[model samples]
Target: MGLRRLAAGLLGAVTATVALAGCTADGRESACDSAGGIVECSPDQRSAAPKITGELLPGGTYDVANQRGQVVVVNFWGSWCAPCRAEADDLENTYQATRASGVTFLGINVQDSRDKAIAFEEGRVSYPSIFDPGSRLALAMDIPPNTIPATVVLDREGRIATVIRAAVKQEGLQPIVERIAAESPEPAGQR
Candidate 1:
């Protein structure tokens, strides 16, 4: 689909009550739902995964465009997001087990100060994460405004294959990543 149409569709979707603003017991923003959870894009509905490039938490830069031909897992999270913390270990474990299969994970940290975010991932998580102090990367992914702890799995062609809203579990995510990683590249012009 054209960018205009995509934008329009996303706009329409956004109006459907994806997130509500509230405070958790800890006084952190509580974001829930993804309008309706994973927006599945048909083959015809596929769009190139948004280009992502930024300074990683520990060091170096990460560019999503460079991950073409590999299945890429993009997870949006924040230090203050309780669900993010709940799933962090599961995500890291999945990453470790799947790396040999050519699956890569990129965490996008949003709405947290650099120090706190880095501290959150320093020892418990092993994957590199983009420190998005602002929501630029989230906006690029067309994430519903204010939703954190969302995950997007990109197919080998770099098109978005699946999106998971809310916290992710290993049981739910492993099969999806394996399936994408195992797919043979589409023939020329077939993608």
Candidate 2:
């Protein structure tokens, strides 16, 4: 009976491995999965951005909950992800342009060692990134299951307003932030 149980467990593990192996054409986890398959979350369907407090890469602590009353842009990235690398400058540029309008940006570094992630950010990304090697932040936000280089825009009330499942560009991000920032917060009771 024990042998049968062991065999079944092994088969299950193998089956899961095989299933995940084909989850992507390159065998890499898809960005959509990390983002919870949600391309966009409407204002009416918006939920609180997950509470993720963590140590920032270089140093300092960040509490996502404290970012209330501002348009918070949460970006999930990895040091090794090509799209993350490609979109780094665009994010920074947009942040610079939109910050005065009450927009803030936070980055979550996942699936990377601290050293490599820090090295990648050195002189490239100006915004702070939490070292979420296990993707805890992404999971907390309920982003699609396996996507990287995902971006989520949270409204002033810290409610999720949009989710972008791919690399973000300056042109695409700026207007979104501007529009969200321009809107007045929902009434206290409405929120």
Candidate 3:
């Protein structure tokens, strides 16, 4: 059983890397019409993002529940997925842009390793990542193994704002994030 879990983790990591790569296609020429089988963002499909627990690298545990009142962009990815890698830079860039505004990006790297995760974030991506090797979190989110490189955006109050199971472009992410970051709860004194 232990061995099986380890294998699953490794597989998840590889898949995430590939997904990242596919998301990196040139934004100017991105297939806005399609994501090569991946789903594009839309209101009907903008379901609640999944929430799960994970192990922070170098030994720590964290969960999205801790991020209430702040907008969170949670991404499920693997090291071997092309689309995930493709969007790494954009993810990093957008995260940097929104962090100051109270938006945070949480990367849940599945089937991947510490080394690869390190390299991916150190180079261009700049967000804290958690490991989901056993896949309890991935399953909770209903993420198919092949349909990875997925992203879930949380509203300011921590409700899932959207789910994008495609090659995420900055333009696609920018507007939603901006909305979340600027979203404010109604004043308690108001009716």
Number of the top lDDT candidate: 2
Where does candidate 2 have its weakest 10-residue lDDT segment? 27-36
| lDDT string, candidate 3, 1-191, tens digits | 99999999999999878554444323411332244443333322233445666678656888888887788888878788898889888788888888888888888888888777767667666667898766566555422323578777777655545557666788778777897677666465641
Candidate 1 structure quality by residue, lDDT tens digits, 52-116: 89999877898888877778998899999999999999899899989899999999998888899
Best-fitting candidate, scored by TM-score: 2
For model 2 the local lDDT of residue 135 reads 86
Better of 1 and 3 by lDDT: 1
Superposed on all Cα atoms, model 2 deviates from the true structure by an RMSD in Å of: 6.3
Residue 117 local lDDT, model 1 = 91
Estimate the lDDT of model 1.
Answer: 0.77
Q: TM-score each candidate.
A: 0.78, 0.79, 0.67
Q: Which candidate do you rate higher for TM-score, 2 or 3?
A: 2
What is the C-alpha local distance difference test score of each model? 0.77, 0.79, 0.67
Clashes (N, CA, C under 3 Å) per candidate: 0, 15, 36
User: Candidate order by TM-score, highest to lowest?
Assistant: 2, 1, 3
